[model samples]
Target: MLLCDVVTTSASVAATRSRLAKVEAIAGLLRRAGDQVGTVVSYLAGAPAQGRIGAGWRTLVGLSVPPAQEPTLTVAAVDTTLGEVAVTSGKGSAARRTTLLEGLFGAATADEQRFLLRLLTGELRQGALEGVMLDAIAAAGDDTVGKQEVRRAFMLSGRLADTATAALTGGAAALAGFGLTLGRPIRPMLASPGESLAEALAMGECVVEYKLDGARIQVHKDGDDVHVYTRTLREITGAVPELVDLVRALDCRTAVLDGETLALDDGGRPRPFQETMSRFGATVERELPLHPYFFDCVHLDGTDLVDAPLRERNAALHRAVGDALVIPGVLAPTGEQAEQVLADALERGHEGVVVKDLDSAYQAGRRGKAWRKIKPVHTLDLVVLAAEWGHGRRTGYLSNLHLGARDPDGGPPVMVGKTFKGLTDELLAWQTTEFPTHETHRDDWAVHLRPRLVVEIALDGVQVSTRYPGGVALRFARVVRYRPDKQPADADTIDAVRALLPGAEAAGRG
Candidate 1:
């Protein structure tokens, strides 16, 4: 019920590197939150607050200031209390927060400024406090809940404070049964192929589908109403009216489909991912036509097909969406055929291929070998060991991420490179709020973080380097996406890095 309670939980979660544990701690806190202010502060200050949670917090707090300037402003505010003032100007970094803090709080002692900054940054360093909140919820509930159920409720409800109120007044099941909803949008299943066809086959006998590189989207259509959501689950229905019309034209009455939406260039080919996302912006050409290549059907009519096996769901998808809106697939009983499809898809300028296990059901929020993504063997699964603070629009948040690979003898990771590309505005906001929790220590310029987050790094090539610790850095590194399935320990190591070198494999596993 106290601010200290919320602050303590945030401190504990931030101090740890285990995401699962951190999530559990936060979920527990949400269930027990009795103090409205405490619940609000804890959720806003916690780590991994991205996507729905971060957006919802920003909306509620009315922090009109862009995420880039938040750290400076928050830090400076430590000396003074700036009540309800909208940040109007951006002055890079050094001058911005100092000016705002001084103006907002007037003149304050140096120590007072420092103290205020700590609170503004949400680094209260409290411990096991979130669990107390969770206990409060469990105590008030009619029935206990699984951690997964708690997480699902927390995520689906959008705001922890609102959801906590619901849970306390009724029960968790009341919140959990909030009905079919949207959260962070369904992400596409990914695959990493084994070196040989036999090896790929040994992993699993899977149905191989054409992997399109267009924008990953989920279409929700009921009667003539159509809603389009990006992979991150932001509603973009108004942004693509043409696509809405296309969905409305479909014969199906109600359906939820997973697909790729793309923009066609003058040549009539599916445009690049960049071009497709460009249409999502406010200033982009509105008349640009977009088409969807639906791959999986999770719901049709009134039936929820999420529980059905992929083979059955694929059939349902065909019957509901028809072939025109769907990407054609290859029923491969053997890995050799899948290899052929992979080559064909790549030759056609597609990304690669997605290999789905026929018998596997849709496993939401879980990445297993059941759904393997076989991209070109060229890209590296790099870990985000550290990140540098951004400037301008990206200031405060660790916009530039430092990548690392496994060690030669299974030791600590070696730094490979850094990247500032392929980030969305939503992603930037999420990173700004979430990254600080993972900070191991900070310098005047950059923050050294515990090597825990793994990201799939797509690059032009691996080049020889003298600047980085790994002896090589990723050339033109860009984020393919965050690999939530990956653990920091599973991230590519220095041994893997050395193996990527010329003739290293023949010598050993680096």
Candidate 2:
């Protein structure tokens, strides 16, 4: 398939808000992708197959190469070229990389050039994200692979490229082949936000576990060798020797433990989110040790209990690890007991409690109503669009913050409201110095950014508003903290914000 063919499909996907339309258009493209299905799917995923070809926004914009008069670049050829660019590094490699980029962009037509630029800069928002692409992949396979089958494969494998290839080639059998590998990390199951403890208790017969504010870590153990992965599935075993040692000491020979890791203060209270996240450095930092709190054990002594109910998994987890590692929870609790659990968690400086249905199996990569997280205060992970300069005593610092929610349709983040609240003088100095690094342009009032930084914003509620494109605005919004561990893609979407309106039930399912 030609690169222009994929580019045209991407444009069509970006032009519509209808999810079925997006899925069908991409499914049509996948039908014609032939042997280059993996390459073409990765492109539609808003990145090259090799990932990060050493190109930046400025470098992409600086190119003066004219577009090709006709479509000539093939999908396979483009994939191979970017693969080479990903390996182009060392002394004097900048000039060599520039030459390769210039040649590639020089060969692309106008529309193809735009698509390439957006893809390289990680801004190719065509709504072909994992969820939509999963549907598309299922659709491309003659409907032989169901949605749940494809999701299971993708979540366990953690790569859309390989999942797509497997679904298209070997059908359902191939997808089923994707299972828990010893060293490989699967996507962690997440909890949906609940309006209140009372609301969550009414859902089902549940176990309410203490929800801690910490980084999600998945530890896989095979004999003495243990590997640690973040929620994004990036491996960081070497940086967390304590966690590795803890997992290595597990009684079971081989196990996959899903848990949260965070640094704690002297009083045993959880530290700030940034303080805990800062411990995940490239090198080991023993001063700030991260404690792992296991909630679910997918694999224990070769039992393969992932498909088992949470009640069974919790029992297995308790048997595998000591009480210090297993998170605190009450099985089959009354409403008052569940509320007390939430109170105890908050008293320990934890986030809240997750009322989890005990019978729900481990459904990775999807947030169902089986688990509901209820916090005393409502919080949303929003993106920082811009920061305005401060005045008076706060002069010379970026004070007021412009916040935005992620667009579900894969467009730029929509501005919901602005807040200068909850920022200390120290934070002011930090953003004033750090915000410039992500600046795209600067006006007299605020420094426009690339919408990359994710901030956890605590808001009272949202109201209907015509000021923002999303038709809603945050009420009494304040900065909780900067979520350095999260990415812009991980921020809460506009649909979630709309769910927080006065009349809405829950913020989101996932």
Q: Count clashes in each candidate, considering only residues at least 3 apart in sequence or on different chains.
A: 27, 0
Tens digit of per-residue lDDT, candidate 1, span 7-95: 44555565664545555566555545543522343343432222122122222223222223222333213212232123333455334
Q: Candidate 2, 76: how far from true, in Å? A: 1.0
Against the reference, the lDDT scores of all candidates come to 0.60, 0.88
Off by over 4 Å in 2: 506-510
Candidate 2 per-residue C-alpha lDDT over 364-472 given as tens digits, one digit per residue, 9 for 90 to 100? 8666688889898999999999999999999899989999998866667989999999998889999999999888899998999888899999999999999988899
Quote each prediction's TM-score.
Answer: 0.62, 0.96
